[model samples]
Target: MDSNSFFWKIQAGTAATPEAVKTLGGKIVRVDAEQGSVETSFEGKRDFTNPTGAIQGGFLAAMLDDTMGPALAATLNEGEFAPTLNLNVSFHRSAVVGPILGKARIVRRGAEIAFLQGELYQADKLIASAVATAVVRKQAKAT
Candidate 1:
C-alpha cells in the first residue's frame, strides 16, 4: 500500500476494491507526483441528488476528500496513512446529475501533517471547493 502503487492502480482503473473510490465512482485522470497533486472524475450518478435535485453537498465533499486524501496518501510510504483531520468545503453552484471533476493539491506536508486544497467541477464549472488537513501516521497493526 504505497502511494506510488496506489497512483498506478488508480491510473489503471484497477484500484483496490469496493471502498470509497469505488463508491464515489472516482476514476483517476492524472497524478503529478512532482507537484503532489491528483485529478479525478466521478460518475455523478443521479441517485445522489437531494430533494431539490441537486447533488448532495456531502457527496461533493466526499469527492473532494477522495481526491485530496489520495493526493497525500499516495505519497506515503508503505505502512503509512494520512487521515483527514478537518475538511472545510464551500459550494459555488448546484450540481445536477452530470460530469464531476475533482482535483487536489498538497499545499504543504511534513512528518506530522499535511494541508491540502481540492475542487469539484461540474462540466468545467466550479461547483465546490475544499481545504483539508490530514495527520500522517503508521497504519494500525492488526491485533
Candidate 2:
C-alpha cells in the first residue's frame, strides 16, 4: 500500500472511521488502489436479524454500501469523499448472524461520479450483491 494513500492512513489510525462502519463491524481486509478494488469483512450481530432469524435485507444492503463506497474512497484524494447517489441491491440468499465477507470494485470513475459494485458472502455462499453510483465531493475546509 502506498503510505500516502487514504486507505493507508485509515489502516494507520490517522483517519476517523464513520460510526456506521463501526456499528456494522466493518474491517478492511485488502485493498488494491490501482484496481480500485477492496475486500472487507463484517460481523452480523443477532440484533441485525429479523423475526425470520435471518439478517434483514436492510442490514445486508448497508454492508454492500459500506463495501462499495470504500472501493471508491480508497482511490480518492485526501480532501475527497464519495456519497452514494443510488444503490441497487439484489438479495440471493438469507444471511444469518455471523461473519460476512464483502468484495467491491469501481466499475467506472469520472471527475465527479463513480460507479461501483459489491457482493456479500457468508460461509462461502453469496448472500447479496449491489451496484451503486456515487457523487464525489470535496470536503469543506475547516476553519
What local distance difference test score does each model get? 0.84, 0.91
The TM-score values for the models, in the order shown, are 0.89, 0.94
Q: What is candidate 1's TM-score against the reference?
A: 0.89
**Lowest lDDT 10-residue stretch of candidate 2:** 1-10
Q: Compose the digit string of candidate 1's lDDT tens values, residues 29-140.
A: 8878778898988977788998899999999999999989878866877667778999999999999887899999999998899999999998788999999999988867
Q: Residue 38, candidate 1: how far off, in angstroms?
A: 0.7
Candidate 2 lDDT, tens digit per residue, 41-93? Answer: 99999999999999999999999999998888888877777889999999999
Quality of model 2 by C-alpha lDDT: 0.91
- Give the poorly placed runs of model 1, Cα more than 4 Å off: 1-15
How many residue pairs clash (N, CA or C atoms closer than 3 angstroms) in each of the candidate models, in the order given?
Answer: 1, 0
